[model samples]
Target chain A: MLLLAVKGITESNRKFLSQYDVTVVTPDTITAQQIPEIVISYAWDDAIGQKILANPNSKLKWIQTQSAGVDYLPLKKLKDFGVVVTNASGLKAIPIAQTVLSYILYFARGLNIYASRTHWEPYTNQYLVTELPVLVFGTGRIGQQIASHIRAFGGTVYGVNTTGHMVDGFDEVYSMHDYQKALAKSRVVVDGLPGTPETDDFFNNHFFDQVNQLFLFINIGRGTTLNQNDLLAAIDDSRVKYAALDVTTPEPLPKNHPLFDRPQVLLTQHTSWGEYVNAGRTGGLFRLFEKNVPSFVKSGTIQYNIVNLDKGY
Target chain B: MLLLAVKGITESNRKFLSQYDVTVVTPDTITAQQIPEIVISYAWDDAIGQKILANPNSKLKWIQTQSAGVDYLPLKKLKDFGVVVTNASGLKAIPIAQTVLSYILYFARGLNIYASRTHWEPYTNQYLVTELPVLVFGTGRIGQQIASHIRAFGGTVYGVNTTGHMVDGFDEVYSMHDYQKALAKSRVVVDGLPGTPETDDFFNNHFFDQVNQLFLFINIGRGTTLNQNDLLAAIDDSRVKYAALDVTTPEPLPKNHPLFDRPQVLLTQHTSWGEYVNAGRTGGLFRLFEKNVPSFVKSGTIQYNIVNLDKGY
Candidate 1:
């Protein structure tokens, strides 16, 4: 029996999974008793998910996540128990790239100001996306796709990675040590980095202060990596002009949070990588689950997108 | 001597035209005496601009317009007077395409809905630009560029033209007669067609009624081509969900108009073909003027982008 944590699984999806005996578990009802059978933690991003992972469930062979970043998962503990993990990474690249471009366009096209205006208030300073320089934090699937999308719009993409070996689609790659140089050329800084101890709170005040021509800060990656207080400080000092945040520190971000009220902050509530055509958000999540199940059933090994325990991504 | 009608002629621009004897004329200041001496009517587009063209000027050899569409001008009379007409067509294509994509992304990324939401209310029906079928009218520089941009985003593009010969970047091409067949498949319809007598008020109730799933009506072209009554009627009947109009009838569209009040309409107020990085909007116009000046000086002829009198575009 497979424990499915994804909510809003349509009837058609259940019919598609007719071959497997599946148990649906929501945040409220998931218990330690069901932990061992929980093969997949699809769409798992809440505190209740912590308990499910914490309970020693030896039978839990694989945890397939709908999110690209597997940072929240207790990967080190899971690895000790020989549990394998895979993420829905490639499926989200398009939507996330679109979201990033939307952020750039929101400012570059002057939509941020124009959307609120009741009368003609055209700004003299607008730019083509091709003319702007964008810096992306990761060189993985999401990073490459975002770079390609920005390039398509005629923007220069600067990628930052550990070693900074040449990456596809990016105009230039900056090593971890020299990333500040790359950031200096950029008008837009995009966080596509997965969460790791190295990445935690990396985008603090100092990071924002080093930025040049800072128009927009985009965080489509794990939110834990960005310091919101520092971001606000940067905004206040005009080091950072605006922010388009898809992910945040606290999921569902308490209703009374200041980020919700700030005009400069486009708080997306983490809905960037979502639905296709008329399909629901679960369509991509379900597709990822279906793709992984066959391999897991045959080899009892996860071959694709298996997260590194130390990296926690 | 050339008649430069464009405002904001910066010092750098004057240096670019150092070889020519240029006479600047504002719309309010231009008189019949000045019109008679005007050898070239560059960047002409106002009511007095029409008067400058209508008043017989024997010295006039070329009439240059900064607009992509020449439909508003009296093309037949200009041609009859043995004058060549050039336009700033290619310059606006990129910005115009960017604007159209902004509208698509606005809806696709749920920015349209999310922008208005006072609280967190993320919609699940949003789509990637690449997943949708985009219907484009007119297969010129602007249309082809728009199609290329959409294709880069992973969307299918349907092109409609007079003959509908195979065009690059478009997934399919439909003849003018068979455009309705293509429109039925698209949720987004982009009007890039230049205005002409044959195309006047072409987008009326009948045009909207044939649309199967009209999610957005994007006009980055001339406004005279679209009938406001039909667009409003289409919106009232729920056939058209939203509109992103970059151009409109009697622009500077009187303050109290309902278009400003409507949430669904993204009235850009003719600001789509806007600023470049260091180059102003006049960069392309200047380049066009610079290109034509040398040739006209030598051969007494303006060659490139000379509008065909019969086409009125």
Candidate 2:
């Protein structure tokens, strides 16, 4: 099987792939004549991916992404082409959950105030996470991991999903239609929803206006799910007490953007998934790829992380 | 019974104490001739406490402190006066433990690096708490709470006390005499030991030299237990990767102190115990006072956090 890896796999991983009778080629080494049957790419390589997809002689049957979110991929085109799509879901769960906890505790313990202090000024606006009732927007792998961690700290976890089906680790689950009740009780709101047309601008003025009280806001999921202007207004009106965003629309969000300078905002530049050591090669992503490869070789499909092309994850 | 509460009791608490037949008086109301049988004071009321204790006609039989640590109190003099001392131990456990976790997660998620960033710069030095093995010195209420929180994140918790006896919430327990092995394996070290003569400068240069690797140091314990210069030297030599101190000797540690300016150090200005809402009056201290009031009124002595005046905790 010919596989084209735009980036992320290491030299050692390339050697490992050799044992599977799979030939791996990078963008530097790939020729127009050598159309790969499988392509492994991350979100940023879309331009190169477009060129390969446009090729009339392209033999691509499946695209495996290194990112949990495949929002940046040409989903409709891939759907039309009948190419199977699988993502690295659950690969970044641990680190991303840890980052979410960091944001929660950062605001809970007033580290946001203490971090910039040059003199001895004790802050008292802090509260314990145990007192926080958290409402997580998505109940998938990442949200579940986050809920488990919050539960460990004796905090209440309220999960929201398309269906209100109860998930393990969450104290309660609310469907999208009935989440307003949970939202009213939660002191902390976390956005773990993926970026899809349905979710784009989901957290806008209408949503912020429903918040019952001033609360901490955290975004570890796709940034497109939020309206940046609405969030700023929420902060201005004291509906959102503080916000820690690991993801933002137009990432590399302009250096002079208003969000960058707000004391109530903590922008991490989407580095939540960057923490895992050698993430692409020996870490979770590689392990996930290793699990899917043998099955993909025998059949033209993968069972794990198979995104519904029509619905989009 | 007459009780002198220098501070911390609210008007509502005073009314509640009335049901117990206890008359609460502040410094302004307590005349020299009006010697109270019991006193409630915090760490900062030492001068007034000294004056009250020096009154030869004093009927003072007990001192109930709002602080967990009694290091600032006149322990020897209280012992000489045959005064029983009880502190608000376990009261600050939850919030203090939350603050400790905040410190751990802050560094683990690279907030220390990203916090100051004005532009989009992703950092890769972040690691999950699960990857860190923590060794906490002192397994009292606060330490155990800290252990449980770390363990919840799948991190190993090694506890150290005077005895090596196993404690709940700790993965392993080591005695002060034999903590070197645990220390060597730990990537994060926390000082939760109380301030006492024996614990003075316990974390000196000799102690820091025994560290096996570059580690994160956290002090939620009394400041006197740590030797600041030794810690600074360790940081300079790269034996200590980062330090987050909630307690520091002579805090409001001088505004120009080197520790305050170091990029690797996070000085929290002794605010770990300050986060509780209305901490002095309606919070933990007052709750503790209420619990102990009934027992003290029924007998000459009360239980719950009785301090060995000679030991100074």
Interface RMSD (C-alpha) of each candidate? Answer: 2.1, 1.8
Residue A137, candidate 2: Cα error in Å is 1.0
* DockQ, all candidates in order: 0.51, 0.63
lDDT of 2 at A173: 99
Candidate 1 structure, TM-score to reference:
0.89
Q: Note the chain A TM-score of all models in turn.
A: 0.86, 0.93
- The chain B TM-scores of all candidates, as shown, are 0.88, 0.94
lDDT score, candidate 1: 0.77
Candidate 2 per-residue C-alpha lDDT over B1-313 given as tens digits, one digit per residue, 9 for 90 to 100: 6777776467898898889787877776767566534454432356567777877656777777777888878788888878788888898888889999999989988899988888887777787787788999999999999999998888899999998999999999999999998988888999999999899999999998987455599999999999999999999988899999999988777878989878899987777865545442336666676677777777766777889887787
Count of backbone clashes, every candidate in sequence? 4, 0
User: Can you give the lDDT of residue A21 in candidate 2?
Assistant: 81
TM-score of each: 0.89, 0.93
Model 1 over residues B1-313: C-alpha lDDT tens digits?
6564654566776665556656566566766677667777777656655666666645777778877788767778787887788887887888878878888888778787767555666666777786668999988899999999988877899999989798988999998888977887898998887888777888888898887458899888789889987898788778998888988897878877777777778877777876565444566577666787777776787778888878876
List of clashing residue pairs for candidate 1: A130-A154, A130-A155, B130-B154, B130-B155
Cα lDDT tens digits for candidate 1, A226-256: 9999898788778888899988888877776
Off by over 4 Å in 1: A1-57, A277-280, A286-295, B1-37, B45-57, B278-281
